[model samples]
Target: MTTQEFWNKVKSPEYKVTQPRLAFADVLVQNQDVMLSAESLYEKTKTIFPKTNLSTIYRNLESLERLNMIYKVTTDDGLNLYKLKCASNEHHHHIICTKCGKVLDIHFCPFDTFSELAGKAGFTITEHRLELYGLCEDCRK
Candidate 1:
């Protein structure tokens, strides 16, 4: 999403987008890959807005997360990584490399067909998160 749209959504009564919120949204928009921890984001922000602190990043990250502008994933090593979300992007799941700790975005939603079958079988599926972990190509090399 564009910065203007993001800011507007945050400006809504329910969101109240502030300076920190704009900073967080701007960073997320730039971070296309490398899902980041709060600390990582703080490090990046320091270069642009040196006055920003880790606490500020942490607060904004959590607040934006609550607003569903981003989502989180806990890596196998127990670190929380975040990524931005948008209307056109589905971001179905990820394929994680256990060896080198890399994450690849997998846009295919395996449940779509299953959900159709489930509907025929009189079942309603609400949601799911499926992650497949293994050695990626570089890791295998």
Candidate 2:
């Protein structure tokens, strides 16, 4: 999402747009293709606004996540990464590059196949997440 669009979603009665929050959002908007750990995000945001703290960054990240303006995924090593939600309004999943942390949107969903299997087994699927991890072309080289 663009910086303006990010701000538009953040402009609500519940959330106040402070400088630190704006800086955090800007960093995410500028790095849409990257998935960053909270620590890495805090460092980048600090570069833009020196007064920001890690706690503030965490709060903003959690709040934005609840607002559906950001996406979060945990790495195999248990590191939580965050990325700005893509501009597409359609339901989608993500494929991440393990070597470079590049995130690509996957428009194709395997939910229907899974759902059919669940129905046969007398089960219902409530929620699901599909994440694929591998090296991107540049990272593979």
> What residue pairs clash in candidate 2, if any at all?
none
Per-prediction TM-score: 0.70, 0.92
Best by lDDT: 2
Tens digits of per-residue lDDT, candidate 2, 21-81, equal 8888889998898989989999999999999999988988888888888888898799999
Off by over 4 Å in 1: 14-19, 89-91, 96-104, 112-124, 133-141
